[model samples]
Target: MGIQVWFIVLGVGAMTLIVWDGKRRRLKQRALSAAGISHNAHAAGSAPIPDLPFEAMLPPEADTPTATLPVNIECISGGSRIGSATHILGKVIADEPVLIKGRLEGTLIAPNHPVSVTASGHVASYIEGSCVDIDGYMVGTLKANTKATLLSRARLQGVVEAPRLECKAGAWLQIDVAQAASRQSVAMVS
Candidate 1:
């Protein structure tokens, strides 16, 4: 056979394979749907609550005056505090609102909750959460899946990923806000 004939045959074979694959995928999807398998199946059931990490579940009293912030000096706050003039570096996971009145330099991860930083807060780490109320200065990636609120006195410079953003009078931001509400909606449904 000539080269052209061979090429035509190969092309036909590839098209056939693609069509077969698509049909197979459709069949699988139908079968799963029939079985009631869905992405949001867990939302309504009272199934055993998945043991989420402490960082994902914010305590109500975390914002109260009597609340004592953890002094791990390793995760959230490191060892830096107000007037320390030191750099806090590492991964920070807080299940409660954390007030930082000092310097920080690392990645902060808080999911399914909101974390607030006071006006004295100066974080140089990536911040991630469902909602983050910032009233200080930050210079890193900031991802608030639901909402990111920047207080009037807040100053931030990082990539933000959220559907809704609230920048008060003097708040600052320097990045795009990626829409993460779909993910949150899925979580809520499941």
Candidate 2:
């Protein structure tokens, strides 16, 4: 009887410690979030994470083909962005708008939506979208079937072939722009 009682007391103590630890972790997470800090350094990436914002919006789950990070593969309809200071490599196919705020070294295909390279974005590959908005730096081919806009802080060094092109003042564009052929081949197949 005495041994059983000691066992029960030890179990209770362990449970109590677990509960307290859980609470402490929650508080720490809250404090970190409030201070503009993120603790989501779980793994690296090589695929496009759907619906993830570029500013520390870490979804509890993500889907990418890299297999290095635990992410989902379910296609999404909304926009997604690579977070700042993050690095992504591999092909990305999305029907929604995508913003790259970090570094991406692969293809970004948004045939129906736009692909925006924010002021902190660095893309070193091909891009295909309805509209391409460049505010940072991009190297490689940029093909926007509809239009491509270069903001004031844009730095582009590659081939750009879009039906329409617009550039803001102070934008650096060393790429040659040519009129793109009609994109009727990949039109909405409805």
Candidate 3:
């Protein structure tokens, strides 16, 4: 009888711990959501959050075409990021990798590093990088020195110039393929 009682107690304790941990996680998730930090895994398949005023997150030099912004201050993991709530209308030049989760309407130049656009990102401008990966919506011209990849959820219109181009199964592309010949000559030479 004592052994049965101990087992019951242990089961109850485990259940209590599980409940408490679930509540704790809920509270933490609520706190993070209120603070504009979202967990990507938890927010998957949900409707996009409304745009917030994220202009203050931009570097002061973002509007200046000639200015080079430092990577360390704006980077999230050695790469620069444009948050989901931000929208910029000018040029962006980065020496390091760039991840876009917002809206950009001008030029993005990262000639030596990769540039990625997430599923929530919208870019209607020119993108130049070493490698470009798009999982969102983009219209205009994209130039990548090495490769350009359009993911399953990506939608692209206009032109793409890359030595290697990959379009996933579900991606939508309406491009002008005639002007995408810049790297073909170089590829043949090498």
Which numbered prediction scores highest in TM-score against the true structure?
3
Name the runs in model 1 displaced over 4 angstroms.
Answer: 1-86, 180-190
- Model 2 spans with C-alpha error above 4 angstroms: 1-77, 181-190
Per residue, candidate 1 scores C-alpha lDDT tens digits across 72-174 of 2213433222343544545567665454666655566777666666666776546777877777776655678788877755666545566787766545444
| Every model: Cα RMSD to truth | 18.1, 17.4, 15.7
* Model 1 TM: 0.48
Query: What TM-score, over all chains together, does every model reach?
Result: 0.48, 0.54, 0.55
lDDT of 3 at 173: 65
Alpha-carbon shift of residue 25 in model 3 (angstroms): 40
Tens digit of per-residue lDDT, candidate 2, span 1-190: 6999999999999999999999997986676566443433211221122222233221123243222232221233468878797876656898788888888766788988988887788876578889888877776678898999877666676567787888775566555555544222121100
Q: In model 1, what lDDT does residue 83 have?
A: 41
Ranked candidates, highest lDDT first: 3, 2, 1
Please report how far candidate 3 places residue 110 from its true position, in Å.
Answer: 0.2
